[model samples]
Target: MKKKYVLLFLIVFMLQHGFSQQMVLKKGTILDALPVQDSIPDTFSLYLPTDFTTEKKWPLLLIFDLEGKEKQALSMFVQAAEDEGYVLAAPRVLDSISLSNSIVKAGKVLSKVVGMLPIHRERIYTAGASSGARFANLVPVFIKDVKGVVSIGSSIANTELLNVKRPFHFIGITNKNDFNFTEILAAKKVLDRFRFPNQVLLHEEQTEWPNIGYLKKSLQLFTLAAMAKGFAVRDSSYIEKALREDIIKVNRLKNAQKLLLAERYLGEMMSIYGAHKNLDSLRQIQKNIRKDQRYRTMRRAENAALFKESLLKEDYQYYIEEDVITHNFNNLGWWNYQKSEIDKFISGNNIYEKEMGNRLLGYINALTEDNIDIVKSEALIDEDALALLYMLKTILEPQNFDFYLETISLSSKNEDFGTALFYLEEALKNGFKDSDKLYGLEGTALLRITPKFNALVEKYLKDARYEIIEE
Candidate 1:
């Protein structure tokens, strides 16, 4: 009987070993993407570290792109993940997929990756950008064992859905120009109310992706959170190193006279490390800093600015819906006036108004982008509504000549000559200098021959009133 039991134990061990061998992947390369499941078009990409082997389990980050740019998103984190020793996976969840379906696909990815790679189930995380970022941050609500998320260029999708029972660390990345900038602050407040572990990295809002340094910062946040919460065994050396670097950063910002930035970073460190490490020294620094008159004024002003942002967001949203539904093209002038007012506030000396103005601009543009998306893909198609939105969009984003041309095309096609003529004048008044393009607009057969159209030609192009530019 003893001999038989020994043989059975040996057989079981071999079987388990065989399974693990099959799961091992080539190190230091992004493996070809695989389907998440049988029928779903959902697929995922992966990158394993050069030293990664089935011998040891690694922490995992399941990243995603809402538009199915999975490999690109995965690549973005490759350097940071490699440096921090994380196994990264990213799902190519298409934008066309419903959010619930995307969530289901993500679950499949987690299950498959956990099985194939020796992933530490307890250390699983998620990440993405924009709408994908919102979805990544939203996943912990449905799934379990998501320890953290790196959400870039977005805020929490819906605060009502947050669960305090299963708290996850959230790291938000955005720039001042990102439409989600103010929304992130608002979302941070909600996270604070629930006492969730969170940090935000605000970068320069520019045309390019944030520098690799930002990704490294995110990795540090993840590492610190994991250690602080005891999800991973504590690494005192790493913690000490991070704290020291952060201190240097705080002092650097203060010396640069970026007082608000310095104060914000100090607050983040206190929130993250207050209980985990000795913070008396940090507290003293913070207390002395808070007593400064400029710091207090800036903090108070920011709160007032946030309140103003919320109120203006309400106004922009109400007008967007009302104007779209009512086809109130007349309100374009009012919208233009609002934009000019925001501009004045932006260029003004008062810090509070300037901040509010910048935030409001981002907020309105985000709303306009959403409205444009709905008009393109929603169940109900409304051309008139789209045209009215274009008219308002031209005013809200006057620098965009696309809205002007779209407005003109839509109005002329719908036989609304009066509205078409009014916007033509408005576009010129707004300093649209492209006179050649103005006379060359296509698809205006019925209305382009009118005197108002000819007037535009004569006033701007220096062309004869009777002469029409043909496409």
Candidate 2:
């Protein structure tokens, strides 16, 4: 009997050890589809730095990708987090779901991560881009312990929800040509009034992710903030290095004759390093930059452009609504004319006007997308309204073949072969050469077999899926 009991105990111990080994997550790489809870359907993606271990708690950045691209979003932050010695997690929340549901899903993932990882509770932050950025901004408001938010390509969704006592570090990263650029500046004022710690980092691209360098700076700011707040031990070397790099960036901008950008970055530097070091010299530099005649002139020009942009946005809003409601196909020419006018501004001599033009272009495209989503979600969908919007999208973004295909499909679905063929030809004119997609497109079975379709395909792509019978 004693020998049998000893054998059973050995078997039980081996099974327990095997299970624990299987549960260990690999370090230094992305792990996808980790279950939040076995009973719950939600999952998340995680990235651990190569040196990650349970020996000490590390900062966690919860990323939200509105398009459900959790792995992609986590990938954007992986290198930054690795260099910063932070843990990265992205919940499988999507824009298709309601805001409340998205929050719940994110909350579950946050809970799971906190439970599973050795996370620094006070150093927790959130990040995302575009609509995802807006969602990240809202996370701190609804969920406690989110100490900061790295919002990219967007601003706060609503300022009224923020509480003065619960202020979190808000780092907004955007490009000059992003439509949300002006909005972020406006939000900075509100944050200032509320005494919420905040900073905005501007890059030079149009409606795209700022490079990994900016992402690294954002995490660095979070680390600095944590040190200032006593949530993490201050590293003197790290703080000095960050300040030096920022100063170098400021000088580079000044040398490039980007006076406004240099001045803005100077102010941001003061905010980040104020708690750790003396900023008297930095403050003097900012004061001198503000006093410079050329800086004043450029600042005035940018303000004027911002004012004009606001008025033009209102005009675009009114016209797009009117056009969509009336199905005003005739106004397509007017839209094209406006796009040309904006193009001239883009390529014009005035730098501020060029940026304004880019922002206007981004604004109109975003407006169209919002209206499209609204029309799509209605109880009874308006096909005509959607068709007009898709047509407008083609004008706004001619090279985006998806919009052209959507236009063709919608027209074909309505049996408006004339309109369908017209758009199909326009698509081919714009260098769309996907003969297979055209042939396989839904509601295009009859249209694709038509002579006009085959001719346009053959003319552009050199091969038509169907032969023209010459009826």
Candidate 3:
């Protein structure tokens, strides 16, 4: 029989230690050097379990690491493979090709080697850290049947490379004091934005011999790998319940932690949504208000009172309202502040603002800080004051609203319909759509009230020419 079809029901092997232990690795070319070209040979490796020789071909786990020789990461894979019942492979990408070319060439070779062994070609999996993680992410797209990927200390920027949506679990492990913290954080943000179901594992917090983090990392890899291969380490509901409990335990704040937590949470909300007047859902309103010290101590009895006040109040003056929305020189100041903040938090730039104006500008621009200057400047309404005046006039006279409507309509037409609709709605609601000369403006205003009006009339002059002329 060919090696793959050979039904060896029971197989065993001896290790260098010479003990005839209960075998998991089948005697195969698990570790071997392969000749890629005539002269250049590349070393590849794998671990096939003894149980793999049973009735069915077993699945395989692929590990890509720096030179694929990191013993700790490899050991974790070994234990996990045996525990979960699968073959494990770790390929030395650097030994074969450069970092950039290693992805395709190494993946093809790995798939070829796995094919010769008694492995379920359909259940191949991959995991890696840093450059290794990058390769694992690339393989599933090119390597035919890679079912899942575990990305550690790396991020997927070009998401098109990820062909299989089976299951991707990203675990970020970075030393808190590592100089690469910013780069790692940027990678984490990219992963988050991609909506990958992931967990940001901070390794610095786990301080023990060999570190508690290694255990956490290994478990994450194992759980996700098992999930991809259609196996259950524990009951699904039990796993979810455990994860939820852990979130609660970790996220709960202690004494004096509430203030910082509130600041961070509100700041985040403001950053995301900006100065939107209508915040969605009661849950969001409550979440925002609960961050404040005043509302933090609120009881069930005070719910109604707190709820009403919080929704109407703009007491939050931190990073959200000030920095993102009310800055002067949204002209230049806002852009500069955003760049600086991004440089500070995301890029690790540590420049101190030497000029007081710039520092004051940052504060006034901050959603968390006082924005009195921005408020004052907005009140002044300097040069473009005529537009506001005309807008007010249009509001008072619905009939004569033609001029304002025409301007906004033209502006919207140049852009997209959404922008046009926004301006149109704002003009109407804020009384800027009225025309004193046109008595039927009120009736016309009522006709265009719904959002459906924008879609219906975006190409109105062309398609609905008769309708416009009739109006």
Clashes of 2: 0
lDDT of 2 by residue, 40-144 (tens): 689899888877767799999999898879899899998898788899999999887888998889888887778667899998899999888999999999988
Best by lDDT: 2
Ranking, lDDT, top scorer first: 2, 1, 3
In order of listing, the candidates' clash counts read 0, 0, 30
Better of 1 and 3 by lDDT: 1
Ranking by TM-score, best first? 2, 1, 3
TM-score of each: 0.83, 0.91, 0.40
Model 1: per-residue Cα lDDT over 34-64, one tens digit each: 6554445666888877666677878999887
lDDT of 3: 0.45
Candidate 3, superposed: residue stretches over 4 Å from native: 1-40, 48-59, 68-73, 82-86, 99-101, 116-123, 157-169, 179-181, 192-195, 205-471
lDDT of 1 at 218: 86
Best candidate per TM-score, number? 2
